[model samples]
Target: MVVVGSGNSGAQIAQELSRTHTVTVAQGRPQPALPQRLLGRDIFDWLSALGLLEVKAASPLGRALQRRDPVIGTNLRHLSRTRQLRLAPRIVGTAGRALITQDGGRLETESVLWATGFRPNYRWLAVDVLTDQGQPMHDGGVTRVPGVFFVGLPWQRTRNSALLGGVGQDAERLIDHHLSSPGPRRTP
Candidate 1:
């Protein structure tokens, strides 16, 4: 099986399935662990620490941390390049076929898994707080998008809020603002 993307979710899923199948991870970046390390742990710890480690929203500094530290950025162990692992061009033209690259050769597979990660689907937002990529532009909980806010991500206003269990605080604050803020302004 082949897993596209290589984020935490994708890595976990790939590793889990690898025990039973010949799993391959197709990463856009040369390595996959960098993104994983952003959470602050080695692959062993990362995969096993699920729920045990605190997961949070991405804050300005946190997001910045991801850019600067990128813990797993250069580590490619998660993706073995040996015959066990192969580096192939990212699939584009179509998802109709499976492409493989190994020992300077190419082939195809019968099964594939696109674990390309999640793209925050914010299409339902009546308000604008997200970037073209659908990610919110905010520091802590303060949004550059005005009246808008974000929390529960990495560095969401507070350290704990980024933790999986801490998201409630961030949500509470945003909800409070939404409830207290005046209704939409009327046109002249």
Candidate 2:
């Protein structure tokens, strides 16, 4: 079995699946914990107002930016300590085969999954308000392009948007507003 992420959720899944299947875990740069919202504020502020400070804020993973802590290490160890979860360096090339480092030698695996997580790909969008990387460049879902808004984007206005459960309401509001408003101008 191929597991795409190395986070808590992915780790748990791989462990369970490995009992009956050979599991390979794809790891990315270690992550900091999700932030706790300050009272009377939304995640946008927590992200924009504080910027680096927010990234440096503390959580279950310890202070956001600060390293040299055992929290992240312990978590990784707990998930990967098992023999079932083998640490493969990384897969190279696009040949549908994986090269994993094991016992000072390279081994091949059957399947692979990109557990790298979500990255915004908005290249098809007709607007320029999005960042170069396709993320909506906005504060609190308020875009530079008026009447064009973003919802369900990571940390869009609140921490809720980042979670699966929180995106529905934001999507509803954005869609409602977009449909209710007039269409774009046409050539006269």
Candidate 3:
């Protein structure tokens, strides 16, 4: 099996498949990573305690520092160390039952899984709130178009905004901001 990407989804897929079948992971870039635990507590707990998770996404420094989403709570390092999973460069193209990699490596596999991330599809929205790249143009989930709030978006308020246990804080802030505003609320 060939897994494209090295993010959380890709790593998880490779790890699970390695237990049952030979697997190769094609990664284009170095995956950002964070330790699941630090100083006897979860990393999320430390971020919350230090208020790092509450940093505004609009801050220039914050945006500059958040280059990629760091994978957490995964055994990717272990899998790599154990030699159970083989790592290769990004796939350049496909040729009849085989994948050609950037490094000139060819992998013949019966199964190919693409674990790339998702892009938000807001084309159904009838508002000009999205950027040219199709991302919502907002300041901490508050878009220029009033009454349209986007929570749980990647880097919405912090690098943690899109994480499962982290989205709540962003959602809470958006709700608070919406309620405190002195304007007529428009239902979507």
Candidate of highest lDDT: 3
Off by over 4 Å in 3: 75-78, 186-188
Compute the lDDT for candidate 1.
Answer: 0.57
Please provide, for model 3 over 6-100, each residue's C-alpha lDDT reduced to its tens digit, 9 standing for 90 to 100. 89888877878888888888988867777789889998898889877767677876776576667766656567778568888999998899999
lDDT of each: 0.57, 0.55, 0.82
What would the TM-scores of all predictions be? Answer: 0.55, 0.56, 0.86
What is the lDDT, from 0 to 100, of the residue 55 in candidate 2?
35
Poorest 10 consecutive residues by lDDT, candidate 3: 68-77
**Which is the leading candidate under TM-score?**
3
- Candidate 2 at 31: error in angstroms? 4.3
Reference-based lDDT, residue 9, model 2 = 66
Local error of candidate 2 at 28, Å? 3.0
Q: Candidate 2: lDDT over CA atoms?
A: 0.55
Arrange candidates, best lDDT first.
Answer: 3, 1, 2
Q: Write the per-residue lDDT of candidate 2 for residues 1-188, one digit (tens) a residue.
A: 66666765665666677777777665554444343344766544555565432231224332323342112212444445665666454433443364543223344566666655566677787987877667778755667775767776655644455456667867776666666667673233
